[model samples]
Target: MSDGLEFLTVEPASDPVARREIVDLLASCGLDYEKQIEFFVTARQEGRLVACAGFEKGIIKDVAICQTLRGSAISLRLVSEVTYLAHSQGYQILFVYTEPHNADFFLGCGFYPLVEVPGQTALLENTPVGIKNYCASLAHYKVEADKIGCVVANANPFTLGHLYLITEAAKSCDWLHLFIVKEDASLFSYHDRFMLAKEMTKDIPNLTLHGGSKYMVSRATFPAYFFKDKGMVGQCRTAVDLLLFRKYIAPALGVTHRFVGTEPFCDTTRKYNNDMKFWLQEPSSIAHSIEVVELERTKRSGIAVSASEVRRLLAGGNFEKIKEFVPKPTFDLIMNKYATSV
Candidate 1:
């Protein structure tokens, strides 16, 4: 608020000029503007943008400050303001991905370091005990098994392919843990996906259904997952997401294997499955190796069953075709929810 400094909140969709200015400011500071960044907190000095930070949901991105104001309080003030903006919108917990060298800056702003990919990216959170607390909560559901396997899926509409993967994974391990993606970015809400997963897997006696959290595959852990064409951003976020699981989630429940459906359609998912092998199976000081099991996707009518296909049928009002891909409960729910509209 000094030296002719003024701060303004910007939403890129509403203000293209401000977005361009923010982009140029970030480029000047040697950072690329990331997509899906909904809001920005910018510091303008005498009508010129000097510093900015982007906010999307609970994750902070592309934080940059003018070299002239690097050591000044503007960086701290900028972070504080964006953090306040997140909190005001009901984001109690927040995550930031920054260059490893810049971790100290956020650390000074009440963000605790979580994990770093060294020279690539560093993940930090506002709560020091966030991961620890999440792991501790998971401890209560810890099943006593020598071989525990885990699966993390969005299961957008919980198709037959999902049922096949879970069924096969549960058979291989003594006990299996299923975690549904908590983020509601999908067409199906988190509530609906979770319910569908529960109803489909209720018959498996050794399986334990856990609600998704920030520690799992979420916006905080993997924001790039919700977007396509992110390039290196996808790689960086994938590493952090897998490391969080290998370092914390796996060991907390004695999980030794991660079962994933073999991706046949999306390049993003195929790459993610490959990354899992490196992050989970490769030896590291963080934790023991977890075997990655890639299962073939179930098929119907000579085609691999996929939620995307199911959605396509729903869009066309082809309930008859949709029933071929999804289970009875899923079809019933879809019919009940979309029958009249279709």
Candidate 2:
């Protein structure tokens, strides 16, 4: 163990050289490091980046250590510091995705394992907010015999297509929980997107809106889900995320059905839908079986209505075209707030 190391925060934008070094270090460790990280803590030995860990939301990712420092206390200290920072920032829990071999290190550091996929990856968390606590938090909504359904969406700006999906799903269930992605990585802020979703769905009597927990398919749990280029990593992350949902969120909410809009484009989303179907059907994956509902297309010009399309039209100064894809509420919001920027 090295005694001369100092721990400090690394701001990627202000220090480009340190950012490059951290990226290189993570890549050399065979971990995906291209995703945006909000907070990073590093252990420097004489001003050299020896070990580092990143926190995005509540997830600890892109953890890397110099080979010479692997067996020492450096990695443990890095995790401890990052977890402390996360706690101070009001995160009640912290999740980490690490390779299977590194599971023991985190387990020893008080991170209980949630899901381990042999040689692939292990999902672990450190805090009292484990699966049970997460499930317990939502227990008030669970009804004994209600046919509860769920739809998790980013809703960058809620669109007519999203409304159509929710409408269709709501018709089939006694109750529906709509989780707007709380991750603020999209073009529209999470606050705006969530507000749009709530405003659009307010009239639906059976619908209840909830902010997506960090445990959902946010950048924290599935960073690659947002990256179009990293298909393999996206699939792996999606599987882990869905597994967590099946094990924790679904049963807690009494969700017997999961609804999603059909993905006509976006191969990544298509794969996610397929994986949802696969994992939800596995007997051991959940307490009770969940029916994965893929609703049909809501389209114009034979193209599906999507937030990305809305963004494209807004960028092109085609407000009229954007109006055709989005609901009235969303269209009004874009015109009022984003038209001049476009």
Candidate 3:
């Protein structure tokens, strides 16, 4: 299937020459080369780079074949090699995002389309049943309520602000579903974050504290790399994430509203909140109607309480001030972990 082409795998982190060739190829093909890519699979015909694909964790991107070879069988062979390499590294489920027009090419390589942003991008996975199975599992957690509210949070270290937001939001809705971001790319591990959230929200009678999933705000659903224009990246990220939420996650759990704390610190987060409003509740005839509610951030000493502040304080060895920003559970965990040093 290679059509007399030789395939070679290069780890871009160490092979700068190969990486440059890939960057040039992607540029010529009109796709930005993402530095976060771990490796690349290159197809060379007589030692000239004719096709290439990149792998970052479980995501496959930057796939570009020379225009002369676009319709040839080499494209499939290139993707198959990349998929095989990704699976060998223990990534069971692989995802790819491409121009909506190029989605069919990947479909030929066995990727199932999950969602598309019309003219922008299309997301696809290796297995057709991956999202369907996830939604089916979520259906078991559905509860009956006139107004079903939900809050998706990372809660790196559970803060008083988070507790306040969830507590107050729970009050306004008959049932609130709190989903903890499951990706462990934060200062705190997902297990500890989940424990802290569980301990703090235990008293809320009408709320269910659920663990994280890939379908929620995760690296796969919301990539934070590759694009030159950060604004366009934010738009695409929120569109993909929120579309999945409204189309699949919300419907599975009977959720009608999403609650978020007002963002005043992080630009990325503030943009995400704004995009959430546009994506989830835009008055389009084909759009799903999921209300977005932004609650005021809890303040202390005239300053808003935030997890980032807690992290800063912890880093500065100012445990005393961290106590004021976080709940007792988080403070206790911090003290327990840093007892020997502090």
For 88-200, candidate 1 gives per-residue lDDT tens digits of 99998888888899899999999998888878988899988888898999999898878999999989899999999999999999999999999888878899899999999
C-alpha lDDT of all candidate models, in order: 0.88, 0.82, 0.87
Candidate 3's residue-wise lDDT over 1-342, tens digit each?
Answer: 336799999998899888889999999998898887888999998889999999988888889999999899898889889989998999888988888999999999999998888789888999989999998998998999799999999998899999999999999999999999998888789999999999999899999989888877777788652232432353686788888888789989999999999987766678789999998998755446999999999999988888877877888899889889998889999998864565
Instruction: Provide TM-scores for the models.
Output: 0.93, 0.86, 0.94
Off by over 4 Å in 1: 1-4, 231-234
Candidate 2 C-alpha lDDT tens digits along 1-342:
449989988767677888888888888887666456777898899878888898877778788898888888787789889988888899868888888888888888889888765568888989645777768988877766668899999997888889999999999999999999887778888999998998889999998898887788776566666765653453475778787788789888889999998887666777788988977766773457788999986998777898777887888899988878998888888988898886
What's every prediction's RMSD, in angstroms?
1.9, 3.0, 2.2
Model 1: lDDT equals 0.88
lDDT of 2: 0.82
Candidate 3 regions exceeding 4 Å error are: 225-234, 285-287, 338-342
- Ten contiguous residues minimizing lDDT sum, candidate 3: 225-234
Cα-based lDDT at residue 63, candidate 3: 92
Q: Residue 332 CA error for candidate 3 (Å)?
A: 1.6
Q: Which candidate order results from sorting by TM-score in descending order?
A: 3, 1, 2
Sum up the clashes in candidate 3.
0
